[model samples]
Target: MAQKNIVVIGAGFAGVYATKKLARKLKHNNDVTITLIDKHSYFTYMTELHEIAANRVAEDAIQYDLHRLFGRRKNVNLVTDTVTTIDRDQHLVKTKHGAYPYDYVILGIGSEPNDFGTPGVKEHGFTLGSWESAIQLKQHITDVVRRGAVEHDPKKRQALLSIVVVGSGFTGTETIGELRDWRDQLAKENKLDPEEIKFSLMEMAPTIMNMLDRSDAAKAEKYMQKRGIAVMKNTGVVGVHEDHVDLKDGSTFPTATLIWTAGVKASDQAAQFGLTQGRGGRIAVNAQMQSQDDDQIYVVGDVSYFAGNSDRGEPQIVQGAEASAQTALSNIIKQINGQAADVAYKASYSGFMVSLGSRYGVANLMGIFHLSGFFAMLMKHLVNMLYFVQIFSGYYLFQYVMHEFFRTQNDRNLMRGHLSRQGNVLWAVPSRIFLGAMWLVDCAYKVSGKESWFVDKLRLPFSWLQPAATSGASAAGADTTSAATGAAASGAADTATTAAKSVFSLSYQYGKDPMMVFDQMPHWMYSITKVLIPNQQVAFFMQKSMTIIEILIGLALVAGLFTWVSGGVSVMFTLIFCLSGMFYWVNIWMIPMAIAVMNGSGRAFGLDKWVVPYLQKVFGKWWYGQPQSLYGQDTVK
Candidate 1:
């Protein structure tokens, strides 16, 4: 039998996951082949584009490899090429690379930024639609500042630093938040005054974050203003010139950078393929994830017009992309198995997580309750990490962890091609060598059972206690000549060894205190750690441990750095993090770190499994910093 070829287009979140699920579902059948076509081999996370554009993160900070998502699926083949035309009549698709003849076609090709026909918008404005666009925006923003710093005229300098972001949707609002952060960092880095930088977010609608609830929208607007962004409601760009944006109200603002994220329209490719388009030129697909007019065709993600509501009762959102993909994969499996392909997909907004720069944001899970402040920020980061784990199979997450821990500022952006500056390649070679060394060390620590090499090489005093104690015991043994002294020595040795073993064991022991073990602790207590300790006792323990650890680590890393020069730089870098930020000084940062370590790496699919060996190799030698690259170095700094 000729094999059934399932061709999927686009490599966005929907297209990437759709191919994976379909391949898995049809893997048992030898008569099925799953081929995914994308313009790029890797999946670029559209959500984190703002972070890249603002320079808080590298371009690859949010990207995941599609091949990693496929795992060991022999049936899945990834082809990187631009699709020029799709001929449904002949069951064929022509791409710049080659032509694909498919038994079934799934068009998950995502949308492009909507210019809304504003003058000079296409030529002047930067759109955060793809990884490339985001990178370009970041570079352009940096160039603007670099040029402006040398300019003598104050107004011209301000104009050069001025950035106008159109639209107030998730992308628009988030981009503004990042822009504020990047601007702040740039101001500080370049010694330019904050007043010289202008970040304006203009929306035609009555409020920003329009998709969010009214209260959330209000909170977001307030938060944005507090972060130095001017949120203009019921205002929009009527025209965009090379150096300025004319507002709808006829007010004009001088600016060098204009970002058009006002709206999104379906890809012309989708319309050319003849899929029924909705209001935004989005392809309309049936409940089964297949095109309404053709079962062999599937359309998922942002391009798909799924039935849903956004305050007003209307169909929108790409959340249905995942739902549609699942259904399409299920249908494809059933079709290959000679069974009924009738799985219906019902789209529902499960949750919404948004990152508002480094500090604050809003979320309404299932549009039921609103979350903001630290909780929302945590949720947003988790959402990003989860997506990383999902698509890249945690490779980039591990890369993130390694970079966070060991890589220097110069080293962080070395492999990131999108973050290149017009500098000599000389700095990059050493950076690559350093990363390569870290990776090799990580691999060795994994392959070999050398879990403590990092600690040993770094010679952390906490770890050195073992050798110090052994030396003390040896000294005591040498002096013990009497029977009574020998007996006392033996007893002390046994007690000390038992205590050390208990403290060294990373796994939580179930035996606990005999008193608690005898209590036959309630089943709920196992899930809830708080119940195990009374609130008062919890407070007491935290108060005591918090100060002691903070002081000791602070003094040792900070004060001790002034004494020693070998690990001084790394220690100072780590210590500066502690004293520099008020957030780090608070309980918020430590509490989460403690909880994550205790919970054992998000239960499953975390990079912990990969990080364990990597950390073991560099454990003592270098501090394992947070898993984000270079503390937003690519942006302004």
Candidate 2:
């Protein structure tokens, strides 16, 4: 059988999920191959772009590596290129790099900001359509604020500090909330008055968050107003200039930054495909998400116009995108197997969730449950985690949680400006190497002997003590015989053998018996350890295994690999020793030192400082928690 090549374009929510579904279904089939193409090598979590722009989260937090996403799938091929056009006659998708021939093509190219022919808007305003754009917006805001902080002229400073956000939909509202919080932080850090900053959200509609319930929308608006953000209703931006924004109502706002989140239309690539364009310049599709002109071509995501149980059209939300993608992939697979395209696209609206900032949110679940404040914020995180787990790995979920919930303002401040210039490596390098060497020496000594110290102690109480004693006795007997000829030499030998025997006997009594150590422990700890390991044989095996593990940990620490992991293990070991009645004065100091090492002491001079960022770039942002230096530089703030 000839192999069927299925091409999926874009790596957004729709493209990603569709490729995953297709890969899973065709994993065992040798007759089918899936190819995924996207302009960027990484997939951006579009929903979280606002957080990036607000500086609430790191830019890397919203990206998932395309290579890693398809790394394990043998039948999936990933192409990082922009699609320029589609050749329907030859069944080929032409990209900037090359053309991919396909038996079927799934277009999930997503959407672009709609400037709506507003004069100077596209040239002067920024939109949150892509990751790069969000980053640009963030950097521009930072630059503006910094300039404002040092400006001597009040008018110029006000203009630099003022920010106008056009449109009060989900993106606009969320961006304003985050921007306001960020502005306050920036002002405090720069020793400027917070009152100097001006933030506004302008919408042409009667209410903000139009997709949200009326009560929820009102609550959101009130929350924004309470936080000192100007909420303008029925206000539309007619044009934007380099230093100010012009509203449709003949009002002008002097601002250096104008953010356009007014609306989104189908990506220009949709029209380039020569497909039947429908409302909003999206590709027209049937109930199954197949193009009206060709059954072999399917469209999904924001670029696909599908009217499912709605007169207007399906909402261009992540949930709808996923559902449409699923339906489209199902139909494509069915057609590949010479079966009918029976599955129809269904629209599902779980609810709308909007994060006001790190501390606040408003959400309506299933149109029945209303949530706000901290609980709503928690729910928002949960929803993000769910989607992350579905589309990416648990690493991304962990990163999201840490960035959203645990990372402090101080930590985020480290990520600002040039990260490559921060952190002192002088002490970190030597300290890590020295600590690792100590562990390695300890491990080597324990494993070098025919029977390790632990094993010797374990066998001492059983049968090895008698053999040791006999050996000592034989040496003493030899010493006695030699005494007949050379009394001085014989006496010295006898004393040495006697000392050795005594030392062995002491070790046998104390070392072999962990119970003796347990007796010295506090009653509370003693009872816990006793209950934990009631079996003597099991305890012996555990001791041996721990020794081997220590050896591995030592090697890793010495190599400067997984520095934090090794340090954490060292802490665990120290704690275990302390609880087992081995609490020496040195052990107490080791605990704190281990903690220091775990907190990125390796980054100062060790391999981790350099390797971590590289790994994060190649594998995505889920490598570890916030580093001491975010982009290889110290905290600028």
Candidate 3:
């Protein structure tokens, strides 16, 4: 008796789990052999990538060994290689290294970042679409920060700190928010000035997080703004230079760090497989999670677009990828058993969660839940833990906890010696170089009052608002209106003009509002107040009370301690003690949380870990001491 062969492409969440389920279901029969083919041996847990870049969590924490993941499966064989082509007629698949015959094939190769014809983006910017990219970004960030520490010039330092994340979509917006926080922590840990750090998230679209409801998008914008992240809406990167990004609005943002997450497109590999692909090059898959034209082949994740009323009929997210894999797995098992089992892959994400560093985050579930402070931070940690537990089971859970506990101890040793050397441009000579040439060209334009060849090629438009000094009021007077009733007309015109300006200003303000932390404070307070106050609605009364209580208790504790120790309370000394204590435990924790819920726990993964270690390796004795020494030179005593 011969065995049936089933080959599944991609080792992502869908492919890996699908393989496991299929193998388990067909194990008893011993009549089916499941072959899992992927470009990588291991499946990447992509959700925690922001933490990796920030160095809050280690790479190995989220990434699982493929063999380890499927060690118990007797009927499954994992093949590590890229699948180059798929032949439907012959039921064969060609790989980069070899070829395999398949009774049924599953395509779940996943997705890649869309450059969208932006010049120099692929050559310059980094996108967080993959583990390798995350690692690269982490290394680059570490190098940039270290270099910033040693840089002599202020302008160059600012540029090194200037991190512009393109695309205000979920991945772009969330990733940039995390980067902002990581920079802040890195700055504090390294004794770098907060003023020197610059982070921006730009989008060409009218708004960000477009998939969310309008209100949520508005809230997200406000949150981004509160953290001082420059939200350049209705603006996009048109060109990427070595040190600057040319925007669609004819402006250039000088930055050394450019992270592109603006858009996503399907892999070119889909076309090679001869699957029917639509907009964004995503393969069109049918109800069984199989390719429409080829029943044996299945496509999952962002690489394949599946239609569904679930999730509001939008495109699939990370959750959808997992769902697709599960469905494909069941169908594969049914086909192997010659059972009439057909299931349509349906995915509806419960909600979305975005973590802003360790303490701050946002979750949109049943209703808009704006999480911050300890609870929100806790949620972020729990989410990370849940992801690991869900994917690899309890095996990595204990290790993750233990690794976090010992992380700070190891971090202390690593935080000392080395200065960051990442993405540090030594000179602004390029700016000056371009500026000088532009000035010369401007001079020529002034002298000749004519368009240059390059200008003509660019099809650049001239400024209609150019000052009257050049064209004079004679050129503008034609647009002026004459008034019949001077006083009344003036008043009416003024009123109308004022109203128009107000409307325009309001719209502009709304558009300019950046996504950041603390924007949800009012809403959160309002919700709490609705429950707390009986007679009148009070905003933030609880937080205010907590702060006051913390202060008073701190004072009482100080007084009591002094009475016990020396039998007398020194008023000035007692006040100082109380204030310092409040600042340390309550104020420090409360304010940042109230603004954004982030904690310095398992959330950090990449640059922070590498930079801290690299610093300790280089600085040795001069390195900053353990986490306790961060507040002051001495311990609590």
- Which of 1 and 3 is the better model by TM-score? 1
Candidates 1 and 3 compared: the better one by lDDT is 1
Distance from true position, residue 617, model 3, in Å?
A: 27
Using lDDT as the yardstick, the better of models 2 and 3 is 2
Considering lDDT, where higher is better, how would the candidates rank from best to worst?
2, 1, 3
Off by over 4 Å in 1: 307-318, 388-392, 400-637
lDDT of 2: 0.76
- State each candidate's clash count: 9, 5, 38
TM-score of each: 0.65, 0.74, 0.61
Give the worst 10-residue stretch by lDDT in candidate 1: 513-522
**lDDT (0 to 1) per candidate:** 0.62, 0.76, 0.60
Model 2 segments beyond 4 Å from truth?
A: 150-154, 188-191, 392-395, 398-452, 455-541, 548-563, 567-597, 604-637
| lDDT at residue 260 of model 2 (Cα atoms) | 91
Better of 2 and 3 by TM-score: 2
